[model samples]
Target: MQSRREFLQSCLATPLLLNNFRYSDEKIITVLGEVTTSQLGPALIHEHILVDFIGADKISSNRWEHSQVISKVLPYLTEIKNRGIKTLVECTPAYIGRDVLLLEKISKQSGIHIITNTGYYGASDNKYLPPWAFRETPVQLARRWISESVNGIEGSKIRPGFIKIGVNPGPLSPMHQKLVKAAALTHLETGLTICSHTGPAIPAFEQIELLEKEGVHPGAFVWVHANSSDTNNFIKAAKMGAWISLDGISDDSLLKNAEIIHLLKTENLLNKVLISHDAGWYKPGEENGGEFRGFTTISDKLLPLLKTKGFTNADLDQLMLKNPVQMLSVRVRKT
Candidate 1:
C-alpha cells in the first residue's frame, strides 16, 4: 500500500485532479466590475482596506468617513500599484467595517482593481458576528450573502468578488460551522470563492472537511492565514487542492516565508500557494488610523529573498500571478 505522502503525490500527478485547480475563462468580480484573470495581473489574494475591532452590535459605517479613509489608505494602494500589483482582495468581512462604497472609491481613485467580499467574520471569539448570525440558519445567512452577490452590496451595484468568512482556530464550533455552511451555500449559488480566516491546521482542515461534506470541493476554499499552520500540514492541504495563503509576509518573516515557499516548490505544490503581506487598512477610532502598514514587503523584501533562494521569474509569477487568478476566479467548484 502507498504511504500517505505517496498517495497524495499520485493524486496531484493525476491530470484530471490537477485540471480542477487550473484557471478557467470565468471573470472575477471587482469593485468596479468583472475582469478577466489575465487582467488581474500580479495580485494580493488577502489584504484589508479598513477594519473595525468593535463588536458587531456597535460597528457602523458612521464611525469612519469615506474621504478620510481614502486619503489615509489610497497612498498605500498607489504604492503597491507602483510595484506592479494590479489587484487587491480586501478580506475584511461585513459587520467589521466592510464598506463596499469605500472600496469602490479607493479603487476608482487609485486605479487599482480592488475586490471586496460578502460574509461574516467569526474569528476573535465571534465578536465580529452580528446578533442575527447566531439566530439565523445557514440557508438564511446564505440568502443574505447571495442577495449581495446578485443585487449588489448595501443597496449599491457593487457585488462581492468572493465570500470571506472567519472561524476560531480550534475544532469547528457550532456557530463557526454554521458560518462555513452558509459560505458553502453562498458559493453554490454565486460561485464566489470562500476565503476563510483560518489559522492552524486543525481548523483549516476542519473547515475543508465541512466544505467537502457540503459538496463543495476543496478547491473552492482558501486556507487563509495558513502560515500559522505547520509546513507539513500545508503539504497535506495543498494536495487536497486547497489554496494555502501565507498572507502574513512581513520584514520580520522574510527568511522563514522564503524557506516555506521553497519547500512548497520542491514538493511541486507552489501552484497551490498564495502570498501577501496581509497588511494595510485605516483602523477606526485610532488616531491617524494608528501605525498603518504599507503593502510593499512582498514586492520590496520577500521577492528579493525568494530570488536569492533560486526562485525564477516564472516561479514568482506562479505565486503572484497565476495562482491567485486560478484561485480567485469565479467558479462553482462542486465535488
Candidate 2:
C-alpha cells in the first residue's frame, strides 16, 4: 500500500501525468501574470484587500475610489510583506469589489504577488449573486468563468488563480449546488482549484462529493473555513485528498487554531493543511473603509504559538510555504 506522502510524490513526479493534467508547467496565475511556484514564497492562501457587502444589484466599481482604498489598504499589505509574506490570495469575488486592476496596482506598489478570482459568491443568502446566476444553467455559468480564465476578467487581461464560490453553512442549497457544479466544470476545463467559503462539514463534504461526481478530484477542492468544522472532519477530508483551509486565525482563536494544527500534525495530515488570517479589506461606505484588520496575526501570534506547541520550523514551512505551493499551483486534478 502506498503511503500518503508517497502517493502525493508520485502524483507530483509522474511526467506523463503532469503532461496530461497540465501540471508540468507548475505556474500560479497572479493579477500581473503567471509566476512559477518557486517565485511564490511564504503565502497567505486566503485574504482580502477590499470587500463591499453591497448586494450584487447595487455593487459597482464606482462605489469606492482606487486611490482612497489603496491608501487605506496598502499599509496592511506592506505589513505582511515586511513579515516575509510573498503572496496574498485576494478572496473578494466579483460583484463584491474584486477589482483586478486595483489588485495589480496594489501588487506593484506593495511588492506582493496578488491573486484574484472569477466566480459569483452565492453565500449571504445569495445576496452577492447577480440575477443571471439564478437564471443561468451551470454549463452557461461555467462557460462564462472559463472564458474569464482564457480571456481575462472584465477585459483586464488579468486571469484568476482559482475558482471562488460560497454556500450557506448547512447542506448545499439548490442554487449553491449549481455554483459547485459550475466550479467543477470550470476546474475541469481551466484547471483552477475551487475554494468554497463553506463553514461546516456538511456543505464541505457535499461540495467535495459534487466535485467528484463531476469527475473532478478532491485535491482540486479547498474547504475554506474548515476551522468551523469538527476536527474529525478535517482528518476525514484531508485523508480524502481535500485541502483543509483553517483561515480564520485571530488573536482570540490562537490556542484553538494551534490545537487543531497539532492534531492534524499528529494525524500526519499536515501536508493537506493551509493557514491564513482571512483578514483585511477597506470596506465601502464605512468611514475610511471601516476598521481594517491587518494581515499579521499568523506572523506575530500563530507561529509563536505553534512553536510553543513543539512545532518545528519545517512544520511551520509546511503550513505556510510548501502546502501553499502544492495547493495553489495550477493543475488539472481529475479523479
Candidate 3:
C-alpha cells in the first residue's frame, strides 16, 4: 500500500492521473462559470452565501437589499480570500435564498472561486421545497437537475458545480428517498458529486444504498456534517469510500474535530476526510449581514491545532487540497 505522503506527491506530479484516469479535459463549475481543478485551491466545501427560509414564498415586503448584502459580505469574503481560501462552495439551494446573481457578484468582487449547487433541500418539513417538487416523480426531479447541470439554472448561463440535497433524521422519508434518487441520477448524468446534509448515520447509510442502487460510485456521495454524527458511524461511512465532510468547523468544535481527525488518521482513512467552516450566511435586507462569521477558522485555527495533534502537513494538504479536487471533479464511467 502506498503511504499518504507518497500518494499526495504522485498526485501533485500528475494530477490528471490522480483519478486513476485522465480528467485534464474536465472543469469544475463555479458561480462565475467553469474553472479547472488546478484553479480550485484550498476550498470550503459547505458554506452559504445567502440563506433565508423564513420568507421563502413571499417576494414583497421582504428584507433583501442587494447593495446592503454585497457591502456587508465583501469584507467577510475578503477575509476568507486572505486566509488562502481560493474556492468557496455555497450550499444554499434554490427557494432558500439561493441568489446566484448575488453569489456571482460576491465571487467577482471577492476574487474567490464561488461554486453553487443544484438540488432540492428536502430535509425540512417540505417548506423549502416547491409545490412542483412534491408532485414530481424521481425521474422528473432527476431530469430537472440534469437540465440544470447540463444547461443552466433558472434560465441563467451559470451552472451548478454539484448536487446538494438533504433528509430528515431516522428512517428515510418518501420525499427524502426521491431526493436521493434524483441526486444519484444527476451524478450518473453529469458526474458531479452529491453532497447530502444528513443528521445521523441511518439517513447517510440509506442515501449510500440508494446511490449504489442507482449505480453511482460511493465516492460520488459526500456525507455533510459528519462531525455531528457518532465516531463509529462516520468511520463506517468513510470505510465505504464516501467523502466524510466535517464542515461544521468552528471555535466551539475545535478540539472535537481534532479528535476526529486523529481517529481517521489512526484508521488510515485520512484521504477521505474533508474540513470546512460551514459558516457565512448573508441575509437579504439585513443590517450588517445578520451575525455573519468569517471563513478563517479552518486555515487560521483548526489546522494549527491539528498539526499539534500529530496530523502532518501532508495529511492537512490532502484534506484541504487533493481531497477537494477528487470530490469536486466529475467521475468518469469506466467503459
Candidate 4:
C-alpha cells in the first residue's frame, strides 16, 4: 500500500489526473478523520476543544466525563459551524489537555472538521513535559512523534494532522531546540506542517534557522502568536516563507490586529498570513466548563473590520480559505 504521504504527493503532482490543481488535490487530516482541502471552508487555524493546564501532572484528576465536556463545548462549536467555519485546528498539545477523543466527539457533534496535532508543548514553563523528555535525544523525540503521525497518537487510529510545539519566550533553551529539531525531523518523515507556539520574533527566527539547518523549508513552519511580536519581524519571517499566524484576534483587539493585517497587505504578503481567536475551550474541573469563548469571534467580528479596512472578498478568501489549505496541506519536499 502506498503510504499516505506518497499518496498525497502522487495526487498533488498530477492535478489533471484529478481535476483542479490547488483545492481539490490536497488532503488534510482532521480529528474525526481525513478530508480534502476543498472541504475545509472558512477555517480557524488555532482553537482548543478542551484544556487541562492546571492538571498537567495528573491528567486523570483533571479528566471529566467526555459527554459532560462535550455538552458544554458542542454548542459553542455549533455556533461556529453555523457562522460558516468548516474546519478548526485544535492547538492543544500533549500533556496539556490534548484530548483527541474529545476533539473527535466535538467535531462530530458540532459538524465541524477538527484537526488535532502531535508534539509536546513544554515551552512556557517546562512543567508540561514528561520527565523522559528531559533525558531524550532529539532523534528519539522525533521518532516518537513520527510514530504518532505515521501510526496514531496513544494507539488510537486517529493520527495527528500537524506538529505542535513551543519554546520559551526568549533564547531557545536546550529542550526547546530539541523539540523544534524533533518537529523538523518529523516533518521530513511525514510531510506534515510544523505549528510551533512561538513569539517575540527572535525565537521564531531561531526556530526557522534550526529547521532550515535540518533542510526543512520555512514554508513548513508556522510562527504562532505572531501578533504579539514586532511588525518588522513578522514581515521579515513571512517574507522568508514562514506562515505568520496572527492568532490573537478578539473584540477589543480588532483594530490592533487590523494594523498588522494592513501591514501584511501593504507588503503584499497576505498569502502568508493566518488569523484566529486562540479562544474557546472547556477547562477541565471548572464550573460550566469555565468561560467558553466561542470560536466564531473572528468570523463575527474581525473579518468585517478587515473588509472596512479595505480587504476585498478575494483577500478574505485567501485568509479564511485558501491560505489555510496551503498552510495545512502536506508539502512535497523537492527531490
Candidate 5:
C-alpha cells in the first residue's frame, strides 16, 4: 500500500501524455496533466456556487439549470476578493443545481481557483434525480467518473478535482450503499480524493472504515465538519489518517473565530487540517440571508479573528495555505 506521503505525491504530480491527442492540433492535456489544487491558484476548500434544489428531481426545470453559469454571483464575490480570498471548492452533487458557469464567473471575477466535485452528496441529500435510486453498479460508477476525470464532465473538458460523498446522520440506507459503491468505484478510476460530509452527530469510524474497504485510500479522503465532534473523535479520525476539516462554528458559523483558531493551533492539528467558512455567496432564501442558511459567520468573520488572535502571515499560510497544498501535494498525480 502506498503511504499517505506517497499517495498525496502521486495525486499531486502532473503528467503530460497523449501528445498525439490535440485540441486544434495542440496536444490535449488530461486531468493527470495537472493536479486540481495545482491548477488552483488560491482556494477555499469548500464553498457553494449556485444551489437551486436539494433534490434534482423535484425541480420542474431543465437538467442543465444545474450547469448554468454563475454570472449573477460575481458581485457577492467582490467582498471575498477584497478580503484577499481566492479559490473555492463547490461540493454540490449532480442534479442538485451545481452551477459551473456561476463558479466560472466567481473564478474570473475573484481570480480564485474553484474546484468542484464528482461524486454524490449525503444519503438524505440526493439531488441527482437519477429517475431511479441506485442505478449504477460500483464498477460502472467508477468507470464513468474516471471517464469524466480524463475527458471532462458530460464529454466536455470541465474536470473535477475531487470525488465527494457524505455519511448522513442516520443509519446506513440502501441509497447510502449505492453511493459508497459508486465512491469506491470512483477511487478506482480517477484516484481523486474523497471529501465526505459527516452528519450532525459526526459519524463513527465505521463509515470511514467502510470507505477504506471500498478502495478509497485514507490519505485521499477527507471527513469534512469533523470539528463538530469532540476532540477525541477529531483526533481519532486524524490518527486513522484522514484529513479533518476544521471550519467549526457555532449556530452562527462565524468565520475563523479566535477561539477555534486557537484550539486548532493548540492541538497541533494545523498541518493535517483545512479551514473555511463554507461561505455561501448567494443570499439565503433567495436574497434574505443570502441563499446559505446558517453559515453567516464565514463572510466577514473568520480571517479577521485569526488576525486578531495574532495569527501572523506565516500562521495563516500554514493553516490556509501550506497545509492544504501539502496535503494535496501528497495524493496528487499529474501526467
Candidate 6:
C-alpha cells in the first residue's frame, strides 16, 4: 500500500552496496500480496509468466489451469530463480492471457516475486471483439480498468499489481491513446505501475506522452520492446523517465546483441534499463515463445559480456537489480 516515492525513499535509506543497494532487513516492505525483503536479488521487469487467449464464449486459461501450468512453467521460472533471479514483473494483462490466479500459482510454485498485471491492452489487440469492440466513453472504460486493477477480476483473488498499455508498431492510434489515458488514470487511482507492449518502434515514447496527458509519472511506467529499437531512441526513452525494457534477448540476432551491449556501455543508463526475454508466449494451445532455453542470456551471456566490458561488480548489480528496484518504486500501483 505504500506509494512509489515512499518505497524508493525507504529503499534509499539503506546504504548502497558493492553491486547495488543492499536491502536492509529493517526497510523491507510488503506489496500487493507479496513481501519484498531488502534481500536485494536480480529482478526481471518485463516478461510473461502465462499467456493464453480469451474469447466471446471461452473462459481462457484460469486458476483451474494452474495445476496443469505449474508443471510446465515451474521448470522455466525455476531456472530463472536458480540463476539468482528473485523477482519478476509479469507484464501480461487481461487480454493477453493475464491470469492472476495462474500467476499467483506460478509465484507460489516458483518462490519468486511474480508481479501480475491488470487493465486491457490496446484496441488493436481486441478491437475485433464486439460489445467491447464498440468504443465507449473514456470515463466508462477507465472505471472498469480501475475496478479490475484494484479489485479482483470477476471476484477472483488475482489483483493486478500494474496497469498495462500498448502502442502498435506505428503511430499511436486514437484507440491506443484512449487506452493510455485510461491506464494512466487507473494507475493514479491504484498506485500500481504501468507497463506497455511497445514494439521496436517509435510509438513507445509517444505513448508515454499520451499517458502524461493524464499526469502519469514516467518513473512508474516501463516501455517495453526497446531491445530492437534504434540506439539513440533507447537512450532518449531512458532520459524521459520510464524504464527501457531490453527484453527481446532471445531473438539471437548478433547485430542486435552487439548493439544492445554497446548501448548498455555507452548510455550508462543501467539504472533506467531492464532485461527480459518476454518468453512463455503460450497462445491457446500454441507455444510461440515457450521453451527450455536455459537462462543462457542472463546467466551466461549478459554477465560475461559485462565482465568482458569491465563492468565492475557494482555496475553489474545496478544494471541487473538496483535499477529495476528503483523503477518499480517510481510508479504508483494500478491496482
TM-score of each: 0.92, 0.92, 0.90, 0.91, 0.74, 0.81
The sequence of per-residue lDDT tens digits that candidate 3 reaches over residues 1-335 is 88756654443332211233223656889978888877887788888877886734663224576777888788888887766678888998878888777788888889999988899888777677888888999899999999988888888888999999988878899888999988887888888899988868889999888888888878888998887788998889899898999999999989998899889989999889988888888765566657888788887677767766776666777777778888898764311
Per-prediction CA RMSD (Å) = 8.3, 7.8, 5.9, 9.1, 10.4, 8.3
| lDDT of candidate 1 over 46-151, digit per residue (tens) | 8988988888889889999888888899888888887778999898899888999988988999999999999999999999888899999999999999999999
Give candidate 4 misplaced runs (Cα > 4 Å): 1-21, 332-335
lDDT of 2 by residue, 1-335 (tens): 98755644443232211111222359999999999977888899999989998888898898889999999988888888777789999999998889999999999999999999988889889999989999999999999999999999998799999999999999899999999999999999998999999999999999999999999999999999998989999999999999999999999999999999999999999999999988897899999899988998888777766766787667777887788888888889999
lDDT by candidate, in order shown: 0.88, 0.89, 0.81, 0.82, 0.57, 0.64
Report the poorest 10 consecutive residues by lDDT, candidate 5: 21-30
lDDT by residue for model 5 (41-152), tens: 3346766755555364564324333222344455556655554455556776666655555455456555656666677665555545364446766666667667877777
State the lDDT of candidate 6 residue by residue for 122-189, as single tens digits: 63555423256247766677788777655667677566666676667788777777777777777787
Candidate 5 local Cα displacement, residue 246, angstroms: 3.1
Candidate 3, superposed: residue stretches over 4 Å from native: 1-25, 59-63, 332-335
Candidate 3 or 6, higher lDDT? 3
Looking at model 6, residue 223 earns an lDDT score of 76
**Candidate 3 clashing pairs, residues 3+ apart or interchain:** 63-285, 64-285, 65-285
Per-residue error for 98 in candidate 5, Å, reads 1.4
Q: Candidates 2 and 3: which is better by lDDT? A: 2
Candidate 4 lDDT over 264-305, as tens digits, reads: 999999999999999887887788778888876677667666
- Give candidate 2 regions above 4 Å deviation: 1-24
